[model samples]
Target: MKRLRLYFALFFILLAVPIVILLSHTYSNLEQESFFLYRRTAESLMATVYQRLQENLLVEEQRPYTHYRYIHVADRAVPQQEGLNLSPLADFPVQSKIPGILGYFQIDPDGSFHSPLLPDKDPAIAVPQREERQEMKDKLATLLEGLFSLTPGLQAQLDELKLEESPPTAKKNSSNFRDNLESRVDITLEQRYEREASESTYRLGSKEDPKTDSLQRRVQKSSLRQAEIFDSQLKDAYSQDLEKAKESAAPQRADDAPDSRVVAGQTNRAFQMGDELRSQDKDVLSEPEAEPEVVAEVDPFQSEVIDNRWLVFYRKVWPQQRRYIQGFAASLPEFLESHLDAAFLNSALPETASYLVFHQGELLEPTPAGQNNPRPLLLHSAALPYPLNDFDLAITVAQLPQSPAHQLVTFLALFLSVLFLGGFLGVYRLTVKQMELAQKKSDFVSAVSHELKTPLTAIRMYGEVLMEGWVEEEKKEGYYQQIHDESVRLSRLIQNVLTLAELERSEWQINLTTVQPVEFVAQITERLSNQVKRAGFEFETVSEGEVKPIQVDTDALTQILINLIDNAIKFSKDAETKKIVLTASQLGNDCYIRVRDFGPGIPSRKLKSIFEKFYRIDNEMTRTTRGTGIGLSLVKMLADAMGAHVDVANRQPGTEFSLRF
Candidate 1:
C-alpha cells in the first residue's frame, strides 16, 4: 500500500509542474494580442479618412470655371491722360439686349492690386464731366435715330449679319446743301470751291488749328454718300472697341502686366485721332508737319484681362466667411453619415476601433470649421495625405470591447495550475514520508515476529527436551531458568505489539494511579539491572526535589522506563564505561524520569524520527542490539496516553531519554 501511494504521488507531481508553466505562457500571449489588434485598427481608420479628403479635393479641382461666373477684378480704373483723374464707373445693368452679355466690369487702372471686388457688389460708377456727358448723349441719339430709320427688309439683313449698320436716310438728313447746286445754279462756285479747298488743307495737318479745320470740313461736306460712309465706319469701330473691352476684362495670363484700355461704352478718341491723321493724304494736307502724331496702341481687350483669385480657407477666417464655410461643410454630414459604422467594422480588433483613426497617418486634427460644424466621418476606398502642414493630430474614438474576460481566464488558469502543482507537491512529500514510515513499521513487525518466535521456540524446545529427559537434573534447572528469561522477553514483545496496535486504533486508555517518581525509576532500574550486569554495565538511580508522586498508569510508567533502560544497555554493550542511570525529579505539577546511558549515542540524523513507530538509529551498534525497535515507539505511545512527553538527547559521554508526566 505504501509503495502504491508513493507512485501515485510521484505521478501527480510530474503532471502539475508542466500545467503551471503552460498557463503562464498563455496569459502573456493574450496581452500581446490585444495590443497588436489595437494598433492595426488605428492604422486602417487613418487610411480611410485620408482617401475621402483626397477625393473631395479632386472633385473641386475638376469643376469648370463657367459655373462660378462672377469675375473678381481690381477696384481702380486709370484715365487716358496722365493727370486726368477719373471717378469709379456706375453699376451697369446686367440685363442687355444681347442675350449673353452680362454687363459688369472690374476697373483697376492704377494697378494697385490689393482689394478684390466681391460678386455680390454693384459695378463701380465714375462721375463724368457735363460737357463729356452731353457729347455722349448727342452721339447716342444720332446712333439710335439711324438704327430706327432702316427699312424692314434691310433691318432683317442687318440683324442676320448682327452688324450695327447706320441707315442712309439719317446720314442724308445731316448732309450740307453745297453739292446740290451744281446744275447751272452756282454763280460763285469757284470762290466757294477755293474756301472749301483751304479748309480741307487746314484739316489735313497743315499746322493751322486742326480742330477748327475738322469742324469746317464736317459743315462743308454736302454729299450724303460721304456722310453715310463716315458714320458707318465710326459705328463699326465703336462696336469693335466694346467687344475688345469685354474680352480684356476676362482673366489674364500669369505673366501679363496691367495696362489701360478703352472702357466699355467709352468713345474711341484714339481711333478718331488716327482717322484725322489718315485724311491728310487725301488732298487735305497743304504741307507735311515736322512731327508725326503719336497714336497709342488701343487694345480694348487689355482691360478685360482678369486675374484669378486663389482663396485658401484655413482654420481661421473672418466671422462671416467662417460661418459660411462651416455651414457648407456641415451640409455634407448626411452624405458621410453611413461610414462611421464601417470604420468600426474595418477594425481588426474591438479595442482597436477606438484607436483606429489615430493609426491612419493621413488623418488630421479637426479644424475649427470641422469642430464647430462637424461633418459625419466618411470612408474612402483609397488613401491620401492629410494637409496638416504644422502639427500632428491624434484622435481617440469610442472605447473598444476587447475580451478582457478571456485574458482574465488565462490568468486564472495559470493561477489554478500553480495551485494544483503546489497541492500535488505537498501530497507527494506527505506520501513519501508516510511510505517511509510504513516500510519501517513493516520491517519492525517482521523483526518483532522473528524475535518473539526465537524465544518462544527456545522455550518450546527446552520443554520438549525436558519431556524427553534429554538433560541432567542440574542442567534442567539451568534450562528452566533460560526458558523463564526467554518467556519474559517474548511476553514483553507481545505486550509492546498489543499496546502499539491499540494506540494505532486509538483505543489505548491510561489507567491512572498515583505512583512516586522515585519508586517508578528504582523499580525499572532493578528490573533491567540483571541484563545490565550480564552486559558488563553498572546501573544507578537518583531521586531529587523531594520527589512527589505523579498521576500516571503504574504499569505504563514502569514499561516506559524499562524500555529506555534496555535500549541504553544494548547500545552501550561495547562502551569503555558501560553505566546506566535512572533519575527522577519533581517539576511543578509534573514528574520527570530520565534514563541515561554511558554508551554510543543515537546519530544526529536519526534523532527526530527516534520515537516514530519501528524507527531505529541506523548504526552498527543498533543493528547488533537485540531489539524489535518498537520498544521506544510503544514507550512514546504509553507516555502520550499518560499525558506525558518522551524525548531523547545526547549527553557529552552517551545518550539520555526523558519522560515528563
Candidate 2:
C-alpha cells in the first residue's frame, strides 16, 4: 500500500510538472493577446473620436449663419455693456440664452465698447480710440441748417430742375451762385451806387441817409439768393458722400470690380432729393445706406453634430482647444455621466477601476475625483466653462468585444494544458507499472535459479557416478551418453538464467577487441557444426571482403552465433533438407553478419516482440523445442552494450537474423 501511494504521488508530480509548464506558457500567451486587444481597442476608439469631431465640424460649417457671424469686438469703453449681451434687444426673449457667447456691449460715450463682466478699472480698455466720424458729420449738418434755411423759394425752383437729366449743367449753375454768394455776404452792410450828375454841382447840404435803408433791403435779397446756391452745392456734396458710403457698405458682389462703381443716375436722384428737402427749408444729410449686418465668420475647422445635442468641434477650435483635448485625454474618468451607452462604459472600464482615454491616436491620463478635487469637465471652445456657457453635448467611444486572435490563443492554451496533463499522467502510470513488473520478474528468476541448481547438481552427480565405471560395462555406455546430454541441457538452462539476470540488472558488459571477420565466422561454424548435424541440419558458411580485423567482443559474438545456430537447428521443421547459412561481409567501417535458416519463419505480429523475455510463438513446434525465452533477449542486450544492433526478418523460404557492428 505504501509503495502504491508513493507511485501515485510520483505519477501526480510527473503529471503536474508538464501541466504547470504548459499552463504558464498558455497564460503568458493569453496576456500578450490581451495586451494586443487593448491596443487595438484604443486605436479604434481614437479613430472614432477623431472622425466624429471632424463630421460635426463639417456639418456646422455648412450652416448659413456660421459663415456670417464671427464679429470681433476689440475695445470696451463701458464696463456695464460689453461682451455678447443680447438683452438690450426688446424683441429677443428675456430668458433666451446663447451658447458660447460671453457678453455684449454698446459703443460708449467715449467711442468704445465694454464688457459688463470685466471691472471698469481694467487697463486693456484704454487702447487706440476710434473717432466716430459719422457722428461728427451729423453735428456739422445741424450747425449749417440756419444758414441754409433762407433759400426756401430758390430751393423750390432748383428742385423743379431735372438734375438727373443734366447733372453737369446744374452743377455749373449751382457753383456760379456759390461764388457770387461768398463774395456778397457780409456782417456790415454798405451800398455802392453808380453816380450820373455829380459833375454839375457839389452835393447840397442835408442829404437823407439812403445808404442804411437801401443796404438793408439789398442784403436781405442777396442772403436769400446765396442760401439757395449754398443749399444746392451742399446737397450735391452730401449726395456724393452718400453714394460713396453706399458703395462701401454693399456686400461684395460676385463679378464686381475691385473698385466698385456708383451709378450716375442714382447719385443725381440722391442729390435731387436733397435739393427738395432744402426747398422745405430743411437741412438734409445723406441717408445712411442700408447694409446687411455681418455678425461673424463660420469656423471651418469645427466638427459636425452626431446627435442633435452634441457639437463636435474637432480640430477647428483655437490652439487652446488642442491643449485642452490633450489634457482631457490624459485624464479620463472611470465613470462618466454621458448619454453614451451604459454597456460601453462598463466594458471599457476594467474591474480595477482603470479606464483609458485616447484623442487623435494618443493615450491620455484620467482626471481623478476626490475630497478636494472635483471632476474636470471638457467644454467646446465656442462654449466657455460652466457658469460661463452651457451645452448639452458629450463625446465617448464604445468598447468592443475581444478579437478572434485573442480568443483563439486562449483556447489553444487551454487545450494544450489539458493534453500535456493527460499525457504526463499516462506516461507516469506506465513507467511505474513497468518498474514493478521488472522487480517481480527479477525475484522470480532468483527463486527459479535456486530451485533448478540443486536438482541439476544432483542429476549430474548421479550420472557422473554411473559413467565412472560404478555400473556394469554395457550400462556404463548408456549412462555416459545420458550424463553428457543431461549436463549440456543443465548448462544451457544455467546460462539462460544468468543472461536474464544480467540483462535485467542492466549490468551486461562487453570487452571489445579486433578480430578477423572470416576467422570469427570459421571458429563459430566449426564449434556449432556438430550440434547442427546432430539436429539433422546442413550448415554453410559464406565470407566476403578481405580478412580484415573488426572491433567486437569475441565471447559475446560466440554466444550470439551459438544461439542462432541452435535455434535454426531446432526450428527448421519444414525443410526436407534442413540448412543453416552463416555469412559475414564488411562495408566501409562496419561489419555485417547474417545467419539464415530454411525454417518456419516467425509470425508477422510476434516478430516485433520476439526479443522480449519469455516471448515466443505459441505453436506445436515451438512448444516441443524445450527452450527458455532468454536467448534472443540476451542477444539484443549484448548487442546494445557492444554498440551494435541485431534484427530478424522473414526470408523468402525461412528466417534470417542479421547483425550490424
Candidate 3:
C-alpha cells in the first residue's frame, strides 16, 4: 500500500507539472491575443488619420505657383506685359479645407514677411480693400508672437534664419531637386511626368517599433487589411512618342535663371489663370518685358510643435534664385479637437482606451483621457510619419479587454484539472483498498492452514494410537473422546468456511418465516448451549417485555446465533466472569436479538469494522485466540440475508452484537 501510494504521488506530480504549464501557456496566449487585437485597432485608426493628412499634403504640394498672384489678359489675346502685378499673398481655398489654419505666410529669403491676407501690390487694379484683411494679418502676427514667446528654441532658430544667407535645409533639398530633374532629362516627356508624379507621393517609411512591426506582420499574414495592386506594364510606343516630345518641346534656360513669364505661360496653359484674373484686374502689361533671370524649386512641407501647445507646418519654395518659406501655424488644442479627437471618437477602440499625443519625447496637452489615472497601462506607441515625424502617438488603456475565448478556455482548463484530480484520487483510493484486501487474504490463508493442521493432527494421532491398541481400557476411552471432540471442531470449521465461500459468491438464499421471540430464543439456546459449555463459557438466554415475533429464516437465524455464541465463548474464555448472554426484546414493531460477552470490550473506533471479512484487531501471527476471523462477518451476512440488520457496540464489560428486524 505504501509503495502504491508513492507511485500515485510520482504520477500525479509528473502529470500535474505539464497540466499547470499547459494552462499557463494557454492563459498567456489569450492575454497576448487580446493586447494584439487592441493595438491593431489603435494603429489602424492612427493610419486613417495619417492617410487623411497625407492626402491633404499631396493636394497642397500640387498647388500651382501662379495661383499666388493675379493676371490680366488684354484684347482677348496673349501678351506677357498685359498682366497685373498683384501681391502673391491672397486668401485661398486651402485655408478653409485644412483644420485649425491660423493663417498662411510666405517669408522671403531677404527676411520679408508676407501674408495671404495682404492686398494687391499694383494699385492700378480696382479691387476692394477690406479692413478685415488687415485684421487677419495682425491676428496672424499675434499668433506667431505668442507661439514664439513660448518656444525659445524655435525663436532662436528663427533668429538664426534672419542671420543666415540661406535656410539650413536649402542646400540638401536643392541638390535632391536638381538630381531628380537631371535624371529625368533623358526620359520621354510622358514617362518623366509619370515618374515625377510617383516620386512626389510621400512614403510612410518603416518606423522602429517592435510591437507594431510584429503586429503589422501578423495583420498582413492574416489578410485582415487588403493592399492595392497596380499595373507595371508600360507602352513602348507611348514611351517613344513621349521621348520625342520631351526633346522637341523642351525650352532652354538663359543665364541659369528661369523666366516667370515663360513659366507662367506654361502654367497658364494648364490652369487657365488669365481667364480667372481678367475681369478682376485691369493694370496689365501690354508686351513682353525683360526681367532678371531666376531659378525656382519647391520642397515638401515640414511640421513642428512649439512649447508642446502649437503645431507649425511650413514649406520652402525657391524662385528667382531666392528662397521663400510658406506655411501656417495652429494651436494644439484646436488641432487635437479637429483631427485627433474626431478620429478617436470615430474609432472602434474600446472606451477604456486612450490616445496620447507626444511632441518629440515630451507629452502634449489637452491631456488625453485616462492620462491622470494612477497606473495607465500602455498598449502601443508609434511615431507619426513625416511631415509630422517630430511627434509620436501612444495608446493606453485603463483596463485591457479580455479575449472572446478567455472565459471558455479558463473554464475548460479548470474542468479538465478537476476531472484529472478526481480520477487520480479515486484510482489511488481503489488501489489502496485492493492492496489491503490482498494482504488480508494472505493472512487468512496462513491462519486457516494453521487452524486446520492443529485439529487434524490431534484427530489423526488419537485415532492412530487407539487403532494400535497401545492404550489401557480407561485411558483408551479418554483418547477416543479427544478424537471425537477434535473431529467435531474440525467439522464446524469446515462448515463455516464453506458458508463464507457461498456468501462471497452470492449464492446463499434465505427462507424467512415468522417466529415468536421465545421460541427463537429456545431454539438458539438448545443449539449453542453445549458448544458454549464445552468452551467453558456460561450461556444464558433472557426475554424482556412482551417480545414480538420476527420475520426471520429459522435455520439462518440459528446459524447466526451459533456463530455469535462461538465468538463470545472464544473471546471471553480468559475473563474472570466468562458469561455469554442471548437477549431478545420488543420495541414497538421491532424485535432485536443481542448476543453479548462479558470480556474485554471492542474499541469504539474499531467496533464498526469488526464485521468486515478477515479483519482482526490482533495481529494474526501474535494472536492467542483459537478461531478464524470470519465468525462475526458470517453472522452479519446471515442477518442481512434474512432481511435483518446487524451492528456491534461496546458493553460495560464486553462487546454486544445486535440483530434487528
Which candidate leads in TM-score? 3
lDDT of 2 at 520: 85
As for lDDT, the candidate ahead, 1 or 3, is 3
Q: Tell me which of candidates 2 and 3 scores higher on TM-score.
A: 3
- Top candidate on lDDT is 3
lDDT against true structure, model 2: 0.45
Clashing pairs in 3: 81-285, 82-284, 82-285, 83-285, 257-294, 258-294
Question: In candidate 2, residue 221 scores what lDDT?
Answer: 15
Task: Write down the TM-score of every candidate.
Answer: 0.48, 0.44, 0.62
Residue-wise C-alpha lDDT for candidate 2, range 2-90, written one tens digit per residue: 78668778877886788678767766555445434443443343334333333433343332221111111112212332221111211
The models' CA-based lDDT, in order, is 0.47, 0.45, 0.62
Question: Candidate 2's error at 301, in angstroms?
Answer: 19
Q: What are the runs in model 2 whose C-alpha is more than 4 Å off?
A: 1-256, 259-426, 432-436, 439-478, 499-509, 573-577, 619-624
Q: What's model 1's overall lDDT? A: 0.47
Worst 10 residues of 3 by lDDT: 224-233
RMSD, each candidate, Å?
A: 29.7, 31.1, 16.2
Clashes of each: 22, 34, 6
The Cα error of candidate 3 at residue 232, in Å, is: 49
